[model samples]
Target: MSVVILTIKISHFINHVNKMLGKVNEEDLKSVIDNTKRLTGNLARISDNLDEKEIANLIKSAVAKS
Candidate 1:
């Protein structure tokens, strides 16, 4: 019963986000997509340069902050 309620709440939240994004203009949306791609590229480069131990520490730090 609780799991079903949680799923309903999450679905409503996603629907709300979709509605908001639907209102954004085309140029702004394009900029957001470009920035996301750049960030992904940067993450790939950073991971490629880091050792296993360094990557594990970075993950641990991210989890702690969140």
Candidate 2:
């Protein structure tokens, strides 16, 4: 029950985001997802040996570069 509600809410949220962002092209969306996957991989690797401050700094740097 909770999962279904969460899925519907998430679907609505994504539609809202698309409307606000002016409709991203399919290729652009795919590229964004690819980049996010790479970022998540980096975060996972960093988490293994990095401290909290270091992880925060990494995220800030990634946001700036992105």
Candidate 3:
């Protein structure tokens, strides 16, 4: 995702949390939970171009050489 879009999501999350401050209601709680889930899901979807085993092999080879 673009940095701009991430920034906007963070801004919206901050605003949503801020607005819920000093209030305790069922709807507010649910909204917070939903927003948290969405943000986490988006974060989990960020592109990962690394291979875990490849990294471990590279480290092992370097350690053996050194």
lDDT of 3 by residue, 1-66 (tens): 999999999999999988867476878888989988986665455425446776567558867998
Give candidate 3 regions above 4 Å deviation: 1-23, 47-66
List RMSD in Å for every model shown: 5.3, 4.5, 15.5
Q: Which regions of candidate 1 fall more than 4 Å away from where they truly are? A: 51-66
lDDT of 1 by residue, 1-66 (tens): 699999999999999999999999989999999988996887688898998889779879977998
TM-score, predicted candidate 1 vs. hidden true structure: 0.55
Candidate 3 has an lDDT of 0.75
Candidate 1's displacement at residue 40, Å, is 1.1
Which residue pairs in candidate 2 have backbone atoms (N, alpha carbon, C) closer than 3 angstroms, thus clashing?
A: none
Steric collisions counted per model: 0, 0, 0
Whole-model Cα lDDT per candidate? 0.90, 0.90, 0.75
Q: In model 1, what lDDT does residue 5 have? A: 100
lDDT of 2 at 17: 93
Q: Write the per-residue lDDT of candidate 2 for residues 15-62, one digit (tens) a residue.
A: 999896677788898899998999799889889999999999988997
Count backbone clashes in candidate 1. Answer: 0
TM-score of 2: 0.61
